[model samples]
Target: MPNTQRLLTARNIWMATVRPNGTPHLVPIWFIWINERIYICTAPESIKARNLRANPNVSVSLEDGNNPLVVECTAKLLDKPFPDEVVRLFKSKFDWNILTDDEYGALFEFTPVKWLLG
Candidate 1:
């Protein structure tokens, strides 16, 4: 199981993925922890989404204030899309009610390949 407690309260993390040309792309994203999974959502057409599709390898960092623990993953967008549980949890925890149904349709789900609490 993931270190659910730590990740759930983490304010933000730098989500890093490799670009097609071999450089890293990093962006700060808010994430939610559910069950044994760390769930994050992003537009399916985003650059990071495209990069992830090209190379499923990704890394996310959660910090204890300024100190960071990095988790690595190889993610695949779920064919079935985000389930209602995910949507509810996401909105409840993160206040993401901004997304309309059409926007929500663009979401993708990712799972961690590995996590390192350093």
Candidate 2:
């Protein structure tokens, strides 16, 4: 089983995406790991969202520097009327509802392809 405690309890994760010019854009954001996939919500016009639109490849790492957990993944933008489970998880974890908010741009699902933990 995945390390549920470590993953879900993490306060923040650093998400890195590739810019159109081949540079990297990284930011700290709230996330939830469910079913082996990482889910993050942000404005569609955000830099990370724009970058993901151009290139789906992404890297995510927990905030802890002493004992780090990183993963490489591809991001997929979820369509309107977001998944029920995703919304529920976000609510329980973050107490925020992405579905009822106009501030949230879109929900992005990141599927891990590789991991680096120490």
Best by TM-score: 2
In lDDT terms, which candidate is top? 2
Query: Tens-digit lDDT track for model 1 on 41-70?
Result: 677778887888899888988756466577
lDDT of each: 0.70, 0.88
In model 2, the number of clashes is 0
Which residue pairs in candidate 1 have backbone atoms (N, alpha carbon, C) closer than 3 angstroms, thus clashing? none
Candidate 2 per-residue lDDT, tens place, 56-97, comes to: 999999988888888889999999888888899889998998
Model 2 per-residue lDDT at 55: 99
Quality of model 1 by C-alpha lDDT:
0.70
Q: What TM-score would every model get versus the actual structure?
A: 0.79, 0.93
Residue 80 error, candidate 1, Å: 4.5
Reference-based TM-score, model 2: 0.93
